[model samples]
Target chain A: MCRAISLSPNSVLYAIGSRSFEKASRFMLENGFSPETKVYESYEEVLDDPYVDAVYVPLPTTLHVRWAVLAAGKRKHVLLEKPAALNLSELDTILEVCESNGVQFMDATMWMHHPRTAEMRALLSDGQRFGQLKAIHSCFTYKADDDFLCNNIRVKPDLDGLGALGDIGWYCIQAILWAADYDLPQTVTSWHEPELNQAGVILSCGSSLYWKDGRIATFYCSFLTNLTMDLSVLGTKGNLHIHDFAVPFRENVASYYSASQFRVPIMSEHSVANDRPQEALMVGEFASLVVEIEGNGSKPEKKWPEISRKTQKVLDAVRASIEKGFQAVQIVS
Target chain B: MCRAISLSPNSVLYAIGSRSFEKASRFMLENGFSPETKVYESYEEVLDDPYVDAVYVPLPTTLHVRWAVLAAGKRKHVLLEKPAALNLSELDTILEVCESNGVQFMDATMWMHHPRTAEMRALLSDGQRFGQLKAIHSCFTYKADDDFLCNNIRVKPDLDGLGALGDIGWYCIQAILWAADYDLPQTVTSWHEPELNQAGVILSCGSSLYWKDGRIATFYCSFLTNLTMDLSVLGTKGNLHIHDFAVPFRENVASYYSASQFRVPIMSEHSVANDRPQEALMVGEFASLVVEIEGNGSKPEKKWPEISRKTQKVLDAVRASIEKGFQAVQIVS
Candidate 1:
């Protein structure tokens, strides 16, 4: 995030915070923060800084609710890390505070801000090219080394209870919703037998989402498989596929495959090159929204929060489905 | 099948039987069958021909039981098109006849004989590279034009009652079984709201397969979506994915993506080029097995029938689950 802010012209690495002052100073030095950057001994100190316009919270999932809610209440635009909270209700609390404070709220899903995403979205929305979405499948997985699997905060129930779903599956869910134009599914059914750690935190899992109109989406996320990031969206007349939906293999160029009609023995491959990485672009986007609200007298961008809420709602439903023996869990929201 | 036979050194286009001798002769001519190829007006006459070693039944699903059983009873090896039968009982009857007559029974799933499949199988079996199989997802779909949806035998209930599940889902179920090393799942649960035509034939459907050991597989097949064929198999340490799994984009060269361990962001893409199309290779393999039984005094190969039976059983279970309102259907076999 600090790197993104450094690369983003619209944003600044204004402050660093840690429980220990020494750690904050070390992080600042390692990340090449400017000498004028403020150093805080604690998160509260960062939030208390009157000059701070927005705060990026990269704390553990367990800390998201408290920190995000406090940051929003402090009238700072909140750039929150993903697996925004343990559940939807917690995220709702943070969102409510942001709304009341007129503060912009956006999850740190960098891929959303990539230029290639807009190009793909254009194809999906084109009736002649993509048509109506029928099915989608997204998967994000990485082989976690023994040490990471055994000792990482992700595997700790108290830290990131959702594990792979929260870490990587969040992106998959977001991609599905994005492809579906944010239409919420009626039910979420987790695939049976999610691998769980001793602490009952999921190490790997998958789920199928069903809409009332029979449109469907399925996703798999794991901490046990080789690195794979795939999103395949099938439409009535076309299809789109990307192998690297989360993080691009290369810094400057990203590619996705698309096919329309039946004239394909080979899909048309599209390569998108960007001047800056997606994270930096994400930082720029969030900062732009902040500027609109803070300087241009514009209303805070509701699109970001709405998208995040829908993703969280589905995530909560998936967790419910897992808890209910992989049965279909209705998404009331 | 005719093209395959022509390409295979061990096989011959000995004869073609149709209700109309003129139609049979026309088909033979169109497919480049030699002038000496025998044309029989009746299927029984072709079966009666002493020179014919095996029969490839590309008849409708409803005709499979009678034709395949008759071919097996005649001591001619049976190469049956899938869905092997409308249900398992019909298939079991045909299998019983084949076993009694000592005839080889292999479903005409051409991709199974592709050299690329064997290469993928080797990777999946390598413990150090792939590890334990965890999940599999396969989908086969093609947009059936209005004429096809209305006039095609595949949409006719009496001819192919299983509909999309039988025609395309057959390939998907087969791929899942192949990935799982033919281990039948304990239960099959059809996804809710499967799209059905006015005649009560499945237009599109999906299902999840679960095993006692927590292995999971999901597949979707449709006659409603644009052309798409995907098979993603996830293992503990590695993963394999093929976009054109059912039919290669190119007849000679096919590619699949694989990654093992942490060296990803770039999956190793492997391409296998075949001297003949997969169908020809399938015919070659089947004919070799037939030759072993007839010429070498060897027993008819049991492996082919076993794999076919497993695939049909799963298809039946999926149909049963759909019949029972998307409830879980146990696989007694």
Candidate 2:
């Protein structure tokens, strides 16, 4: 993430902070941070820096609200990594602070800013090409090694407590929401037999969502399977497919497949090349938003934060459905 | 189907039958069947022919039992089209008579005969490449024109009574079962909001299945969407993807994609060339099984019958789930 920010033309990896200055220093040195980059022993020190216009919070999901709120309070633009927070309530808290303080807030979902994503969006919104969305299936899974499963922050109940559902599942849910043009689902239902660790953190799970208009989406996220990322969006007239969705196989050129009303359906692969990595683009996008607010005295962009909140709400509903023994949980919004 | 049977070197298109002699004659002429091929005014006439070793029943769901039973009673090998019967009871009656008569029974699920399917099965069974089966998603959907939606046999309550769930959904359910090596799921649950016509026949729907081992599968079938047929099988160690699972894009060569453990996950597309179309291969396989029974005095192959039964069972379960308002219906076998 630090490297991603540094790669952005308008962004800089200005500071490193951790409870341990040595660990932060090691991270800075190992990641080839500039020698002039500031190192702070406490997160408070980074937020206190007068020259720091923004702070990127890459803390575990459990700490998102605290750190993001602090950054917002300090008048720092907030770029928070996903899953944005443990739940919607926490995310709302962070967003509220950002709103009150006039700080731009965007979660770090790199794929959202990829050039390939824009190409996919273009095809999906074209009625003649894609028509009305019917169903979507998004999956993101990775085999987590024994060491990581046993000791990773993701599996720890106190850290990224949502585990695979929050870590990778967020991407899947986000993809579904993104494909649906951010329309909130009317109902959410989790699949039975969600794999959970001893601490009750989800390791793997799946859920389905339904819209009032009869459109539906299903997603699966797992830390117990071989690395696979797929986003398939089917519409009345066409289809959109992305295999390497969460992360592109080739960073520079991302490829997607689409077909429109073929007498014999045949998907044609379309590739979009980016001048910089997707993460860099995400950083650049976020940085530009922060620039607009800080330099032009513009209000913060609500789009990114609104997207984050919806993703968080859907995630919470999925968790609720899982907890309620896979019952259908109605989404009020 | 006549063309497929004629293409197989060992299987000749022996007979055509319809209620109308003119219709049967038209079919025989259109397909360029051997001039000596018999055209019967009724299905029973074709079944009663002493030289006809096998009969392919392409009748609608309501008529399957009567015609299949007649063929089996006449000691003709029964090659039944998919959604073999209205439900398990009907299929069981057909199977029982075939068993009693010592005649071969097989469903006309053409993809099962594709060489590419065998390659996919090999990879899925390989513990090193694919590991234990985890999740599957099979979707087969096609847009129905105005005329078809209003007048097609598939949409009629008394014809293809199962509607989309029986027509195209049959292929999706069969694909899931075939990928799972015919292990029946313990529970089946339909997604809410299945689209239905005025006759209460499903036009579009989806269902999810669960095994006791925590493996899961979901499938979507529709007549209200663009043409899309996909079978995605995800295992612990690898993934198998087939875009055109129900029908191959090319008749001579079929393509599929698979990937094993990769730190950087990547899918490699593979094409398997076939001497004939999958339908021809299916007919050839069924014919060979019949020949073994008739010539070698061997018992009918139990594999194909069992596969067809299981597919029908799952399809029935999905209907029950949908009828019961998307409740999870437990499978006895």
Candidate 3:
């Protein structure tokens, strides 16, 4: 992520921070950080730096509310890694603090900023080409080795808590919501018998989201299967399929398939090239928002935070459904 | 179908039948059936012809039991069109009579006979390549125009009582079972709020199938969306995805994508060519079975009826779930 920020023309790798000074300095040296960059022994010191315009929090999910709230309270723009918080309540607290401080906030879901995403969005929104969205299926899975299953932060209850759903499923949920133009689903129901580790941390799970308008989406995420990332959206008039939506197979160009009405349907492959990686584009977009807020005296962009909040809300509903024996949990938001 | 049989060296188009003699004659002429083909005014007449060793029944769901039973009673091998029957009981009757009469029976799920399907099955069966099956998601949908939605036999409740669940979902369910090596799921639960026509026939619906071993499959079928036939199976070590599982986009060759263990997963595109369409291969296979029963006096192939029965059993459970307000239905079989 720091590398991505450095690659963005609109952003600078201004500072580095870790709990230990040695770790921070090592990260800087190994990652080729500029020698002139400030290094902080603690996150608070980085937040306290007045020269720093924005802070990106890549901390564990359990610490998101604490550090993000602190960063926002310090009036720094916040870009936090996802599973934004342990739940929506924590996310709400972070968002509230950011709003009170008039600081821009966004989650680090890089694919949302991909140029191909914008192209997909346009195609989905076009009535003649895509028509009304009917159903979506997204899957993100990667086989976790014994080492990862035993020690990864994602499988630790205190660090990520939500496990596979929070780590990779968040991207699937976000993709579904994005395809639906950020419309919140009416109900969410978890699939039966989600695979969980000995600690009761989820290793694999799936859920279905239903809207009143009859638009439905299903997603599955796992740490127990081969690496697979796919998103398929079916509409009344057309269909869209991406083999790798969480991350592109190649950094330079990403491809998806699209097909319209036909008795014998034939899909046309569409690929979009990127001068910079999607993460860099995400950083550039965030930096641009900060530039508008800090340099031009404009209000922070509400769209980014709003999207993040919606994603978190649905995440909470999915968790609730899983907790309630896979019953349908209504999304009040 | 006549053309398919004509293309196969081992099969012959011996007869055509419909309620009206003119309609049967016209169909034979339109399909380029050999002039030696017998045109019968009624199905019973064709079934009564001792020279005909087998009969393909393409009647609607409502007529399946009566005609199929009569065809088997006449000691003719029966190749039935899909939605084998309205429910399991009706299918059981047909299967029992076929067994009693010592005649082979097969459902015309043409894709199952495709060479590509065998290739996919081979990959799925390989423990090293595909590992144990974990999950599957299948979708088969096609936009039915206003005229067809109002007038097509598929939308008529009495003619095809199961509607989309029977017409398209039959293929999805079969694909899921095939991927799982024909293992019957223990429970099936329909998705909520399936779209229904005025006659209460389902226009669109989805369901989830759960097995005792924690393997699960979800499928969606509709007559209300753009054409999409996708079957995605994820296993512990590898994944298989076919966008056109129900029918190939082209008549000659079909393709699917596969990937196995990798940190940065890369998919290999596989295409299998066919000298004839899948339907022809299906007819050829069925005819070979019939020839064995007659020419070689071999006992009927048990695999075909066993697979069809299992597919129908699950189809019945899905319909039961829908009928019981989306509750999970247990499969006794």
Residue-level error in angstroms, candidate 3, position A125: 0.8
Candidate 2 Cα outliers beyond 4 Å, as residue runs: B262-264
Clashing pairs for predicted structure model 2, backbone only: none
- Candidate 2 residue A27 Cα shift, in angstroms, is 1.3
Off by over 4 Å in 1: none
Best by DockQ: 2
lDDT of 1 at A208: 91
In order, candidate lDDTs are: 0.91, 0.92, 0.91
Please give the TM-score for the first chain of candidate 3.
Answer: 0.98
* Superposition error at A221 for model 3 (Å): 0.8
Please provide, for model 2 over A1-333, each residue's C-alpha lDDT reduced to its tens digit, 9 standing for 90 to 100: 887888899988888889998998898889888999999999999999989999888899888989999999999999999999999988999999999999999999999999889889999999999989999999999888999999999999999999999999999999999999999999999998899999999999999999977899999999988888999999999998888999999989999988779545788889899999999999999999888988898899999999999999999999999999999999977
Ranking by DockQ: 2, 3, 1
Error of 3 at A179 (Å): 0.7
> Residues B1-333, candidate 1, lDDT per residue (tens digit)?
788898999999888999998898888878777999999999999899999999999999999999998888889999999899998899999999999999999999999999999999999999988998988899999889999999999999999888999999999999999999998899999898789999999999999999977688999999988888999998888889899999999999999998777565577889999999999999999999999999998998898889989999999899999899878888975
Query: Which lDDT value does model 1 have at A315?
Result: 94
Tell me the tens digit of each residue's lDDT in model 2 across B178-245: 88999999999999999999989999999989998888999999999888899999998999998899
Candidate 2 at residue A137, lDDT? Answer: 96
Among incorrect, acceptable, medium and high, the docking class of model 1 is: medium
lDDT of candidate 1 over A1-333, digit per residue (tens)? 788899999988888889999988898888778999988898999999998999999889999999999999999999999978888889999999999999999999999989999999999999888888999999998878899988999999889888999999999999999999998999998887788988999988889999988899999998987778999999999999988899988879899999889566478889999999999999999999999999998999999999999999999999899999888999875
Among these predictions, the greatest lDDT belongs to: 2
